[model samples]
Target: MFGVEARALMLEGVNELADAVQVTMGPKGRNVVIELSYGTPKITKDGVTVARSMAFENRVKNVGAALVKQVANATNAVAGDGTTLATVLARSIFAEGTKSVAAGMNAMDLRRGMNMAVDTVVEYLKSKAKTISTPTEYAQVASISANGDAEVGDLVAKALEKVGKEGVITISEGKTLENELEVIDGLKLDRGYLLTNFITNTRTQKCELDDPLILVHEKKISEASKLKPLLQLVVKLQRPLFIVADDVVGEALTALVVNKVRAGLKVCVIKAPGFGSYRIDHLLDFVALTGSKLISESTSLKLEDVTVEMLGNAKKIIVTKDDTIILGAVGDKQVIQERRDEVTSQLKKATAKFDKEKLEQRLSRLSGGVAVIKVGGASDVEISEKKDRVVDALNSARAAAYEGIVPGGGVALLQASRELDKIKTTNFEEKVGVQIIQIAMKIPAYIIAANAGYEASMVVGKLLEKIENDSFGFDAAQGEYVDMFKAGIVDPVKVLRRAIQDAVSVSTLLTTTEAVVYPNYTSNSNSNLHYN
Candidate 1:
């Protein structure tokens, strides 16, 4: 008897791991998990993870279980959905190729055939994918399977959409823009010239605007009135104004106030309504008072909500109902303010790349061929275990059918049993392969039932009983649950058709080539190594 090498053990482990989750890839299936660590142990039902871990445990000598590792790694990287496909395809190639090798056929021919089969599977997936056009769709797909908060999803979607529209979206620390409205810095009233200094005098509080330039700092009316010649020269510049302040207004200035809404000039009032006041809460209230978006770090952000772009355009423009610095310009404000439309239009052009119509067209294409079935919300670990059972069934089916998930696992296998019971063949070994494959076909159903906490043999027996009786396959396709226990579609053969095209191609190629080559995977090793 030839001794089982570590390589063979690892390959078998990959087989088992993939076998564990193959059946659950479709809508009606489940997930699987394995807990190797403690203290809120990590868990996953992904085929590659289980197979890799299994390979690591079984191969002591490491006779290139690395290839086994590779297979499991690739499978797991794809998530459990496609790992089963990878394993089943690999195993089928091996099965047929091994036969060919024994019969003096080239193993390379079998590998080439297997490669073709893998390509076919990929082609199928590619055909099923939706063309991504806009960042919104990209964000949608990313957020669809996320575990984070709703706001995070919104951020991602918005960012992607913005990037789709614009070349890049710039983020700022001062005011992070979100869907919610916010405010920032503010000022108060009823005080004198200096905010921090003493101020019993109320006469020097107000400043007038002729050539309305926003003042960033406080300027008394006495000092500002002398700029009569300066006023006429600056007002006609066609520029935006910013007014800053140092102190508050007295009781009499309410009658003398100026910065009206008719000017169409954007103003930035730093210390406004609450300035020079004894109370601080009113300053916060003043922030909430402003209708325009303000953003700040020092004051209440809700009221000071200033975005990055807002700050970028801000000049020495501050004008409050309290007349301190009524009008002032920050370095050639006329140049930017006059050309604001050109700047905004240019920025908007680079911000979002995706056209709305293109996005809609892509969405239209993705609308069909989508089947979203909710699975049992079991614990992550529980989901993993159950999924494993399903995958095992699918892989067993694939191994047995030589191309697809059959209706069984270890118990009588599938293809072998089917051939033994139905298909006739003159070659004894060929008949034997088919016979065992038949029993393997149903291995998954048995495993799923057992994992679901039922007796494997009895559960599978019932499944077959149901399949022998009715047209439940049609019912299942129509979204009707054919409870094999309740309805007669129990044999699990219904699952064997999901990848029929795959099965036909792989099976025919493998049979035609009849040469098996070693698989490359190192994730786990098998305790039970079966060889014929």
Candidate 2:
């Protein structure tokens, strides 16, 4: 009696916290910084983090707190996102299941039936997805869908081609880009190709440029000879040049900096140690030494450091009179002087606004395909959480970005709730798990529809109708909105339904069976909790 009541009471408390946290799971999630009355100050929207941080001795005996942390931790693990959905789903299932348990229903039987239901849902979601070819559509979906700074629309699309769907990684803190990635158009290769040199060996050794005219395997102006056609134009710029060879002839590089700084040319050094391998430590020291711009790149053929380091796989390292820039791969180095199908061509337009045909042409120039995904939401929280849901919906697809609420993670708990509500007991656990998933998936399904201004009930009816007819599609979120119907993409609701069913099949087995375990349970956990 006590455990039952305590579990129920904990469920209620979990719901309360979930309610507070679910709405703030993404980049646009709510910012909460609370100064507690008697504990450490706290802040964050991650459901799991916040839940774990909470610990106060209360009448509920920490049941509520324990549940909150479980849901939070679960949410973070599955999706790299989706904090709030975990909370809401866990609490909702417990809340509903406790009612039946209190009414004297068999807990094990209900748990089993619910698990069966969730299994059905998971299988359903898997059947709906199809593989893609080009990355253009993916890029568009992500760009158009992501919130804030509409200006990044073009940049996002172009980078997709360069990085590929899987490689087009974004570094962000809570949905906002930390590095402020902007496309650079000023340093155009115009020749249609900027050399590619791959460093497949060396790890953390210093790169030295040993010769003035004898170039290393890579194709940077620092190593390329004055005789090379690509660098003939540098003479036209009339910038003082210090090509680091055996040693400095005099203050040659400095003299150039003196004249060039006034003309917007600060300092230009090819390879202070000739134009070959130069030390990064040396580069940094020299930059600090001369207060002049220093460029760092590995002529070494090792991919470990270049590919491993965030900025290593670069092919072109430019230390000009004004700003110092590194282009292409860095630590993971690749050098190709010969132009290929369209690497140079694509690199030429990496900073430009994408024209569907133009981008298609440029990317097609390369043999491999590219993809991009963007998610949209009504507000910050909506956008952030929805992004995770979209990623989950498009699981295993290329890098994606979106905004909206998360679907729950500890789906097993919710599946249990389904059995309690089911009319049968044979595959009762399995059957009910399906229903709970169907209902929970409703979170994203209805919202996606509602955001498009659709009537949720009507869309749901249509989907159910489809299910009855054994039709291929589903009661998708966009289907409810009606506006997004033309898009061939399956709805998030359908995807989750499949996942829920599959999970229940496996998850229900975890439900513990006992004669009785609630003698000390509370009798008053849900008397007057507010929903809003």
Candidate 3:
């Protein structure tokens, strides 16, 4: 399809998806009940989840829906809490852009204008953002993201208080009916076991080792011969062996797998974290944490000559497909503290922003512990939904901590739209494009008010009249206008910034698209048409 007809079909798709997703937008947004392929139906208020579950029978419409889904997914991946807002923005942009294009406006010029407007709004948001650091501020942001759930908000704040901003916080199902938070004296790595065959627990799909002897190798172990002596010693001692190396491949990996399958040898191998010199620094940190010596070419130590005393010991280690957690690492406190001080010194001297960030992360991992939030509910469906909220809350809190926050309830974007009028455009079409975005920016605040049973136009009009106070807006929950920040209503600046940028990126591409293609599957045909 080409021209107006194609764009019209795509707009139908955009509207269909936006309509379903926008309902779950604000504090009072309604939950969407999605039927699953198996088991009970899933109920959620998560915008990304709702967007992902949507599908249209019409292929062209599905393409439109998929494009909106991309915006939601990208927002979720980058900023975590603004997926719904991103969808709302995308729908509005494409809807308005489609009409402009149908009326003979240049799509490219319009896109350029939209981009310019988005850039201005993003800068405006950054300028108006207030940095938040206290636990109370963290809870406020979390609560709003969790759809006004105070308990989830408190839990997230407490987790961040315990784990620090850079530390890892993981969400899982609770064993009991009450939500619980656990702070572990452990370290988490992004790297996991190299192969699933090393897994010992089928239920969790993890490789679990108890009182494991950790081997920290700086170089690859390609030959099984170099590992023979260490393997023999571990087997004789009847202890599980956990290997962290640059890479474990070829004959060495094969031998380990064969021994694990046939001889019931408890062993697992994972590639060390980071790369190049960074990898060496991470290995040194790991070694210091575990009281293990590094088997490196820099040292006189060789793999075959390594003794049991040189190996690190841990109370327990859990290895999953994407990450690993080391619990109760057995290392000397003084040595760990020394390593911590060294990293601190290096961090203070670091000049580059990237180097400083990496150093900060290492310092956090060294001193800051890991936190686990166990979400609880009466049923599997309830637990799943609550877990999603918890995750969103956590992510929002982290983002707020990093880049500060702005007025919530869409007041930030609503006020930012006013700045678009000041943006000078080169042509009438470009000016129209800027006008389109200016109107689109108001939609979030409008839908948020409309969803709460208030007259959206009245709320938006009143807010615009009071635009001098950037933080002033309608508090739909209370049915009154108030300062959003004073009312504890806030959103991470990063979330809002990313949402606008991503929405414009995908929506403008969609607005300018003159063609779409899909497989024509007949009723009796076995051909599978998949749209990703």
lDDT tens readout by residue for model 2, 1-532: 2446555556556556665665443223454555557745555444455566566555463555564555455444433333445455555555555555666666676676555545544443344333334444443333222321233333454555555543323322233432133333112111111101111112522121111111121233322223233123333433222232233223433333433444433222333321233233233323222223332234333212222111112234344222333333222112122222234454456554333333333233222222334444445544554444344333212323221111112222223333334444465444543354446544533333343455746655555444322222222322322222223232233223323332233223222312222224345764554321
Tens-place lDDT digits, model 1, residues 218-284:
2222333332332333335554333223332452122112322334332233343332431232222
- TM-scores for all predictions: 0.32, 0.46, 0.77
Give stretches of model 2 more than 4 Å off: 24-69, 133-136, 139-158, 172-180, 183-315, 318-435, 443-480, 483-532
Where is the poorest 10-residue window by lDDT in model 1? 365-374
Q: Report the candidate with higher lDDT, 2 versus 3.
A: 3
After superposing all C-alphas onto the true structure, candidate 1 shows an RMSD in angstroms of 18.7
Q: What is the C-alpha lDDT of each candidate?
A: 0.34, 0.37, 0.90
Pitting candidate 1 against candidate 2, the one with the higher lDDT is 2
lDDT score, candidate 1, position 44:
53
Model 3 stretches with alpha carbons more than 4 Å out: 188-285, 296-300, 303-367, 521-532
lDDT of 3: 0.90
Give stretches of model 1 more than 4 Å off.
Answer: 1-7, 20-33, 41-44, 56-66, 75-81, 120-532
Tell me the deviation in Å of residue 85 in model 3: 0.4
Q: After superposition, how far is residue 205 of candidate 2 from its true place, in Å?
A: 23
Q: Name the best candidate (by lDDT).
A: 3
Clashes of each: 122, 100, 0
